[model samples]
Target: MSDDLKVTAELRESFGKGAARKLRALGKIPAVLYGHGTEPVHVSLPGHQMLLILRKSNAVLELDIDGKGQLALVKDVQKDPVRQIIEHIDLIVVRKGEKVTIDVPIHLEGEAAPGTTVNQDSNTISLEALATAIPESVVVSIEGAEDGTQIFAKDLILPEGSSLITDEDTLIVAISIAQEQDLGEETDEAPAEEAAPAAE
Candidate 1:
């Protein structure tokens, strides 16, 4: 949960849609940082650098503003539907050893029994982990698993200090036999030729 990402942000005085658009034109992302009963601070972050840091799941950020370091987590991100560019971002300030609940992706390992298909009911599980050490993903093994086998959330072996926040009975993965698709028979019907007598 180390804040591997460090970036500098500038205070943004302007507000509203027009201002946000102008910032995007300059390759800056408008963002708000607020948490722990603190006032929301508006700022502009470097678009390219933020994009690269966000490639990882649950990215933790160490923001250096005016020589003051603040630890934060990405809470929400708004993006343009068509352009797929960052529109606005919302961040929550956090501190060391703080427990936060976040969704961690499930990684499937190995193959299930032959002729059987692995049906994953849930791809991510909710975990209560330290803000600085949140897991990137959890791996579940289905190797040699037989049909009708189901894995539940409670059965997951969590990382060192993380705990499952999702319901224990939640179905994570289900191994079942694959159903074969059958195509309907094709018709051989063809259009009849017009009679030449009509021309007479």
Candidate 2:
């Protein structure tokens, strides 16, 4: 993890919806941290800074909780449905070199063979990797792949230390022939009298 991901948080003493709304109004986000059989600690984080850091997936935060240092992983986020506002966040404690299981997004590197339609069945894959060294995403290349070609989860090439946690048989991508759309030219050529008789 980079030092840019580090954040200084304040231990929150208040709880409940009203307190949370007040915190948000003050440009702070309400959050809870827990793991390793420890009691959950409620904290308030800088909203703008956290928003920027969370743009990347699986963000690991090196936190300063009232002068005490702790490492935590972004576990889950709750947002407002209409406004997309960050309502709350859940953090799980982690240590350096600890292996954590998380889903990594899949990125396609190249285009398939011309005229072939590419169908992506899975958008992300599960991986078990060191918490501090988690990869941002897994790349799968389809350059020059022909129609009827299929790529499965087992075929993915992962980062050096990461291991696949998803089932091996899961389909990732499938390439097939693209179907042409009908232009309705045939319907225009039919006689009006014949079409009326068929409708009756």
Candidate 3:
């Protein structure tokens, strides 16, 4: 299941650090909405509400501003390192039903074959999906994969309403034999050379 997020925003007229700090004290998050060739709009959103909606990565927000509705995609989130609070957020205006390219996390699942290891070449891949229906992430399986086996972007199963924008040849992940396992092989034959005599 997916998360449904809606945020209410008020048109903001003030700008700069002073106004922003003041807004923060009142638990409002200063934000800007831009993109789709429209002029930027400054607004203040409820901080608590925005935080709840932002917990999910790549969240799509339905912004209700003065009874006006618009589709918004999270572009950037500024945080205060010390407080771990969201200082500001940038939302890109998007149209419903339009495909926008974004990176979705790649989830590694299942264990590889015994004595083998898995190495992820890419953490995420860009995909063109419906603005209002963007997926949370892409999942790939490595169940019982042996050494030298590789998973490519094209091999991923995209969620409904999502399409791959990355190159089909791009390496997504790979599995290989563990070094210790390879070194564990022993020889039956004993060494021909004699060891040096123990010190007297």
Candidate 4:
């Protein structure tokens, strides 16, 4: 959180769907910044620059607005699926040391013990971490784990200034036996009935 992300932004003069379409046509994204009990400020950002900076989830953005500096957090983003472009974004003003709950992805590294398969039911863990220093993701080691072994939220080791916001017993990952594939020809399992001798 060293203010590594900086973007050039300007005050949005016009507002509405038509105005937004015009901005998009000009390769700019319409955005709003509101938080900390301040009035929502409408602005426009460079589409390319904003996309690059938003590569990281919960990105901390430093906005240079008309030569003034503003600290903000990426709270929401709206995008077009087909075009893969940023349509709009919402930013929340935040200060250092403020806590926020966000989902940190779970990274499972290393192969499980021989004959044991890894089942990842939870890919991200919800935790309360500093808005400024929130971790990019959470790493859990399943190395040499045996079958039926489970790792829970309470067992996670958080870095300083971070706290567990999710349930303690929430299962994150477990080691289990792999399912065997059925490769044989399919057949109906209903048993055939025996016939009487010549209907006697």
Candidate that would win on lDDT: 2
Where in model 3 is the C-alpha error above 4 Å?
1-4, 181-200
The TM-score values for the models, in the order shown, are 0.87, 0.91, 0.86, 0.86
Which segments of model 4 are wrong by more than 4 Å? 1-4, 181-200
Q: Candidate 1 clash total?
A: 2
The true-versus-predicted C-alpha distance at residue 125 of model 4, in Å, is 1.4
If both were scored by lDDT, which would come out higher, candidate 3 or candidate 4? Answer: 3
Model 1 lDDT tens row, 81-200: 998888999999999989888999999999999999899999999999999898889999999999999999999889988998999999999998876532212222221223345555
- Per-residue lDDT for 1-200 in model 3, tens only? 13357778899999999999999999999999999789999999998878778777788888888999888888999999998888899999988778899999999988899988899999999999988788888989899999999999889999998888999999999898778744544322223222233331
- Candidate maximizing TM-score: 2
lDDT of each: 0.89, 0.94, 0.87, 0.84
Model 4's TM-score against the true structure: 0.86
The lDDT-based order of candidates, best leading, equals: 2, 1, 3, 4
Q: Model 4, range 91-157, lDDT digits (tens) per residue?
A: 9988777888888888887889998778888888888888878888888888899988999998887
Give the per-residue Cα lDDT of candidate 4 at 147: 89
Record all residue pairs in model 2 with backbone atoms less than 3 Å apart, i.e. clashing.
Answer: none
* Stretches of model 2 off by over 4 angstroms after superposition: 181-200
